[model samples]
Target: MEYRKKNSITGVLRGATFSGLLLCMAALLAGCSKDPAAGPEGGVVTVSFAAPAIGQETAVQIASAASQAQNGQSPATRAALAENTTVRVVAFTAATGNPVQANYVAEQTYYMSGGKLVPCTVDDNGSFVAVAPDAKMELERGSYDFYAITPALPLGSDKATVSVAHKVDYAASATKGVTVDASKTYTLTQLDRKCVRVTFVIKKSANFTELTALSVTPSGAGLSMPNLPAAQSVKMGADIPAAAGSETLTVPASAFTNTDATTATAATVLLPRSAADILLTCDLTYTTATGSSRQTSFSSTAKNLALEKGKHYTFTLTIYPFDVSFTVKAEFETTISDWTDVPAPAYPYVSEGRYIVSRDALGSSDQPLHPDWTAATMPAHNEVSAYNALSSEFEVAAEDCNSADASGVTPNPGNYQYTWANALPACAAYTQAGTSAGQWRLPTIKELETIYAKKDGLTGVGSFTSYYYWSATELSGASYGAWAVDFAHGNTDGNGKSSHNYVRCVRDI
Candidate 1:
């Protein structure tokens, strides 16, 4: 009996029943004389994939499960593709043991169908079907080599090369030189999980306040595809690193959850297997009991951290209190376990400036004048007045101590110092949090002195210099002299208006 080629075999043989019929037809034509160069148009090829197996590190798996149960917790949720997945398959002539360009035969994609994978194609409306009427796979009854990849990437004209996206759940398997008898179903090797799960745990200490930033720099492997397909290199993540450079994942402080008073769960992420040791750096920014900000950082290398496939690595960082002089030491511990689902911690802060406050007992003087301070810029050294002319001086109020610098220029103007004329307008023009012009002004002499007293409490807002700061108070009986405060020793002194001193603006709440 002669088998005739049809418009499409995938469209007609969409179900198991139809596929079985095709298999029987191919088996019956097994003895028919057909050229190897031309495919067996009548023969059918059926393919199926096996689910990935759990890793074999029994001790770690058992302990992990036991610990979760003992702690009344569930396994962490993860991003895995086991139940429903798509795979791309390519076929080539079983010429040599290895796949070659000249040996390429045909390629087709498969999707899930009733618990089994079936050859599929996109229809005109973009819905997937068994196959498009215009395109389908037809193979002769012969031995062929097959290569497969899951969570398939788009196939190009050249079968071997394809672009992979950043951080994909990737897997690949190959079956070599297998006889394709239409009556027999071919099961390629199992598609195992090819990536590792990385989780972070922060061990809190009595002196621990907050972890501002953390970054992990990978030397190799975790940020790229495992060398596969022979001679082809594929890179992933935002930027591929050079020989000495590295890629990293920087998690902000807010992304951690304080599960308990002593321990907290941080970010959990997936990375491809690494061929080299992984190195990471953690930076902590915290406040001292005296309301002063302090920063400390430490780095460690996970020696021989190949990051085997389907494994989980837990890194615990413990911070130590500083010495009386504010010196600190930190330690790190790493644990390996079977890969399991893990939930990422939630980020803190509902809105800007909305954060938890400490209930520690303290005097009113221990608090900062402005807990949320916004630092302003001073005028340029060679800058001219932004508002007033060179021959102008702002009129001082009669109350010398109360005589503050007004916002606008005065009618009775005297030799205006470029720095002094620019100072008041710079503060008035400064805007933040809906602050309008005239809201901020040069601090009065007394106000400047008070800031110096409580300056140490201004933690994490920014820093200050020990130099002199301009004050709005005019010097008594001096035409061009204004009162200024030297933060170096909290001394009040008179400085000529022409001199340029640091200008810090303050506003009433």
Candidate 2:
């Protein structure tokens, strides 16, 4: 009996020791199990397992159901384990980074029926309301993603992640046919796409300063620009999606020709009358299945396109000049009539054209104005409406001038009342005075000052000659010689009255 008792004690001790060893092994396993990483930068993912409780006597029926069947297996327990053991993923993203045409955008980012990530086109600013709580989707037992492509996304919260929860029971066997049946019953509904509207018509003349001038700022459909002067050759570009698909470029009023024509050989500015020489350019854009954008620039070559003002075009004018500046007149002196004549002023024996009508007719400063003026039929500005107006008054005599009214010395003349109101309206009126025999008058001192451009040397624009072209009227003092423009080095010589000089005609609007 003593020997038997000692054997029993030894057996009990062995059992206890085995139990301690098992506990140690379990602790080590729990501490050392490998786990997966989860975050925006996704990598391998993992979860831990919970072992079954020991020495717990559950009720007969409940225990049988909860506990493993033969060889650690049960239907209910097996299902629960299977549900916890594996997970499926859902994916999301923005199809397009374009905002609705409003100050702000309110969007609802959600999964659609049949597992689609569909987005509604937004046109106004505000939150999306009246959306259902649940949505239908079709997804296999794997991974998925969701997101918005609209403008608000950048200002919105970071990407949201939903990890799948799963379990598996070692004590309960699982069947091969086990499934989660995630049947099109997921929801990302009412995901607000809040936004503000920014609706505006294209500025009549786009101020380079006002435009955002960014790469993705869309100007028109199928077009994008940096709101700046475009360069000739572009480097490899980065892509940005927009709301529009196409774009049009418009020049104010009318720049290029509207009919078929050809460009001149070496002319920088081509105003084609019957030939094609004008050009317009535009940018290109690409759309994604989810509505993204990528810009590719292109140039346009056409004979004529009727371009109206205020219309918006995708391509901006980056490198171009539109028109020629106004021509300026110069001054000179002569020795014909003494400037002291007051009672009755008389014209010289002959007259010349300010600029030898044909540039080839010109010569040195001391040379004769024109070889033919001495013998040709040269008329006085007094015969032309423009000069007559300056000589006579605010209004000239229709017989020799353009109008019957007379100024003699007020309003447009030496009068104290010279207003931009009168001049500006008259200038604008000239636009409609085509072929009215003659239109536009010689500018008085103040008016002419605008075009009296002078520089260090007569390098370009004006004729590089030192000669006089007579003004219609006499100087402020009758004894003073009538004013004349000198073209050589921009100046005015008003000392020679009877001196023979050039004449140019003008009219009133």
Candidate 3:
């Protein structure tokens, strides 16, 4: 009988001594045993395990999962494990020629020792001994399947024991069996892992300056294997930190393909592959200029995310201001040619609708409006569209100039034609000729002064009475009085709220 060898490079000698031939024949005869529990009839097999290069995507997933598990709570931090972290390897063999139901035969922990994984043995007392690069196992002379796991914490043979918290990477090779032979040494290499890498990228807008903290939580953090029972649900989270004075958070270089100096990213996490959807929630906290703090949250779900054995997924979040308003051309035409030229008018350049105001109001101390106020020079100031005195340009309603009825009659019987309460609603209801309803309000004192200073430019366009026009700004110390602009002399003064005056409305660009 001749001994059969598999996965062995060394060949047997053609001519052997009589005694050696007899010994080989006996070993070959013993290799025919069908019982797996039977003692090895062949020579000892030295099995060495080597990890293939986990592609960038897989590496990122591992890092991301680990980061989330370790830092998912308050005061989050990065994971303790790194690229070179020690990983425990375990080997399993089929109990009855079926890889799905396997039995653990050997275990060894390895670390990246000088760029390669060096195996270590755990004694009965749990103490570890630095061993040779390979793990030796003795088995009966027969074919056997091998299943292995890395980062191998003690996850008994059950799938329920495997968790994202443990960060286990799985690999199995059943197509090629290790045939034990008494006369040869067999080696097993290339145990590739089945896992997914996840990365999170956070971006903030310039207007969101007060953002203080950010955190990400992931749902359904568990492993899904083909032969094992489905895994239970798990949640993991991580805190993401932003760079100083920047609109980005700091992420590891391994997480992104383009690592330019200007880009910031969050740490990558690794997770076991799953057939179910993975959901993530992001929470952000910010403070206002008044020292008030608030928190906002956003959610993103990867529907039916079937993470393959070796792939990467990235999630991104962008935080912006709650209120976003931009200047849009009013519905009505604003061309100067549309206005009817009148003789001996109170002001000039009045159109049928609203006027095209410069960004900076005339006589505005912030910046002077040039005679040639083009769009470039007179940029729109929508930020201060409300009542800020520092804003330069604004549109004024031509209603008051059209007629006395459009001037807004007094809502109260007192001397004041319009109180603050009365003025606000009147502006809301006021409409100009050939224009739709708009979000109009009483002009600020600065806006009134601008219209008055530019009165010479509008001398022939529209009619204006030399009287004080009410402004939205109230006297800082006097609750009973509000500021007013006297168009007659382009001067501003505080007047009693009870005192009646002309009313003109203004709206943002």
In the range 142-238, model 1's lDDT, one tens digit per residue, is 7888777666555445555445432454555667788776644566654544444555655544444443332222221121222211212332111
The reply for model 3, stretches above 4 Å from the true place, is 1-41, 55-97, 100-107, 121-135, 139-142, 155-175, 180-192, 206-280, 286-309, 323-509
Q: Which model, 2 or 3, shows the larger TM-score?
A: 3
lDDT of each: 0.46, 0.26, 0.44
Q: Which stretches of candidate 1 lie over 4 Å from their true place?
A: 1-81, 111-115, 118-137, 162-166, 183-185, 205-245, 251-279, 283-311, 320-509
Local error of candidate 3 at 177, Å?
Answer: 1.8
Give the TM-score of each candidate: 0.38, 0.22, 0.35
Candidate number with greatest TM-score: 1
Q: Return the TM-score for candidate 2, rounded to 2 decimals.
A: 0.22
State the lDDT of candidate 3 residue by residue for 174-284, as single tens digits.
223566455343344334434434445554545456554433323211222222223322211111111112111223233333232212345333444334444444444
> For candidate 3, which ten residues in a row score worst on lDDT?
325-334
* Top-down lDDT ranking: 1, 3, 2
What CA RMSD would you report for each candidate?
A: 21.6, 29.1, 20.5
Please give the RMSD of candidate 2 to the true structure. Answer: 29.1
lDDT of 2 by residue, 107-222 (tens): 24321223233332222221222334443233234343332221111122322311110011001110112122233333321111111111111111121222222121233322
